[model samples]
Target: MEVENEEPSWFVYLVRTSKSALYCGITNDLQRRFKQHQEGKGAKALRGKGPLQLVWSQSEINKSEALKTEIAIKKLRKVQKEHLVKQAVRFDRK
Candidate 1:
C-alpha cells in the first residue's frame, strides 16, 4: 500500500443560474462537480434552475479553506456576490 504525497487542490466556485441566482459550493474536482450541476444531478436548489454558468472560481486551496470560504460566500447577499463576480477577487486566504 502507498499514499500519494500531493493533496488534491480544492476550489471554491460560484455558479450563475439561468434565473440570475448564484450557487456556491466547494469541490476538489471542479470539472466533475460543475458537470453534475449542469446535469441537474447535484444541489437540489440548482436542480430546476438549469443553464448554470461557472461565474467565478478560486483554485489551489485546501479542503478546509475551500469549505470555509464556501460557507462565508453562501452567507453573503446577492449584490455582494455579484460584486465579487465582477471583481473576481481572490478571497481565500490563510
Candidate 2:
C-alpha cells in the first residue's frame, strides 16, 4: 500500500502571459516551474507564451490540495480569475 504524502510544501500559482492570459498550475518549486515555463518546457499551452509573470500563489498546502485548487482556478472564467488575482494581492500589500 502507498502512503499519502502529507507534507504541506506544495503551491498553486497563477501566471500571467504577455498576452494578458492567465494560467493556473500547481508546483512545489515555484521558481523551477517558472524557469521551465520561460524556457518553453513547462505546460504545452504556456509554450511560446513567453514573459510570464507570477501574479498569485498560495503556498504551504499539500499536493492534493494544490491539485484541487489548480482545477478550481482553471474552471473559473477569465473575469473571475482576474478578480482572484486582484483580491489575492490586496492582502499582501496592506
Candidate 3:
C-alpha cells in the first residue's frame, strides 16, 4: 500500500474582515484556517470579527518562505495590502 499526502502545499494568506480590515496569516490548509476563523478560534484580534473572507493567498515551496511572506505582509499598511491584493489579482488573470 502507498501512502497519500493530503496536506496542502503551505501558503501565506490574507483575510478581509467584515469591517474591511486585512489579516495576514500562514497555514498549510486554507479551508481549515478559514473554518477556524469562522468559529472564532483563530487569532485573538480576529475572534470577534470573523468569519473572515479570504481576500488573497499564495503558496510557497516551503515553510520558511511562507513565514517570510506572512511577516512581509503583516508589515504592510492597509493601502499597501490593497495594492498587493490588486497585484495578485492581476497576476492570476494572466
Candidate 4:
C-alpha cells in the first residue's frame, strides 16, 4: 500500500443562488460541497435555491482561518458580501 502525501487545504466560498442571492461557506472540499449545495442537500438556506453557481472561492487557508473568515463574511450585509466577491475576482485576475 502506498500513501499519497497531499497537503490539506481549506477554502471559503461564495455561491450565487437561483434567485441571485449569495451563499457563503467554508469547506475542505469545495467541489463536493458545491455539488451538495447545487443538489439541494446542503445548507437549509440553500435548499430550494437550485441552479446555484459557484462565484468565488479562496484557497490555501487552514481550518481555523477559514472558519474565522466565514464568520466574518456571514456577518456582512448583502452589498458588503458583493464587494468581497468583487475583490476576490479582481485578485484572481491579477
Candidate 5:
C-alpha cells in the first residue's frame, strides 16, 4: 500500500489590541483563534486586551513556516507592524 502525503494549512495572523498594539500569532484555525482572543481565552499576553481587530493574516503551507513567519512579524516594532497593516489595507482597497 502507498501512503498519501497531506499538505498542512496554517494561518499567520495579526490582531490589533485595544491599546492599538499589534499581536502576531499562528494557528491552524483562524476563526477559533480570533474567537479565543475576543473571549480573553487566547494568549495570556493578550488578556485584558479584548475586542481585538483582525488587522492582517496570510495562509501558509506548513505549521513550521507559519510559525517562523509569525515570529518574524512579532519581532517587528510597532511602527513596522502598523506599516504592514496599512499596506494590507491598501491592497484590500485596491
Candidate 6:
C-alpha cells in the first residue's frame, strides 16, 4: 500500500486595520479567519486592530506555498506590500 500525500488548500491574506496598518496571515478559510480577527479571537497582534478589512487574498495555493508567500510578503516594505496588494486586486477583478 502506498500513502498519497495530500496538499491542503490554503490562502495568503492581508487585512488593513482602522489605523491603516497591514496584517499578514495564512488560512484555509479566509472568511472565517477574518471574522475571528474581527472578533478579537485571532492573532494577538491583530486583536485590537479592528475593524479589520480584508485587503488582499490569494487563493488556490497549498499550505506550503501559502506559508512561503506569507513570509515573502511580510518581509516586503510597506510600499512594496501595497503595490503587491494593488497588483493582486487588479488581477482579482479581471
Candidate number achieving the greatest lDDT relative to the actual structure: 1
Q: Where does candidate 4 stray beyond 4 Å?
A: 1-8, 89-94
Candidate 2 displacement at residue 63 in angstroms: 0.7
lDDT of 2 by residue, 17-64 (tens): 999999988899999998999999999989888788999888744787
Clashing pairs in 5: none
lDDT of each: 0.87, 0.83, 0.80, 0.81, 0.81, 0.81
Candidates 2 and 5 compared: the better one by lDDT is 2
Model 2 error, position 62 (Å): 1.0
RMSD, each candidate, Å? 3.0, 5.4, 4.8, 4.9, 4.8, 4.6
TM-score winner between candidates 4 and 5: 5
Off by over 4 Å in 2: 1-7, 89-94
> How many clashes in each candidate?
0, 0, 0, 0, 0, 0
TM-score result, candidate 6: 0.81
Summarize candidate 5's per-residue lDDT along 1-94 as a digit string, tens digits: 9976756588888898888878888899999999999999999879998678998988877898887787777777788778878887421211
- Whole-model lDDT, model 2: 0.83
What tens digits encode model 4's per-residue C-alpha lDDT throughout 1-94?
9987656598888999888899889899999999889788899999988789998888744798778777877887898778877777422211
- Clashing residue pairs, candidate 1? none
* lDDT of residue 67 for candidate 5: 74
Per-residue lDDT of candidate 1, residues 8-69 (tens digit): 59999999999998999988888999999998888998998888999999874489878888
Q: How far is candidate 2 from the true structure (C-alpha RMSD, Å)?
A: 5.4
Ten-residue region with minimum lDDT total, candidate 3: 85-94
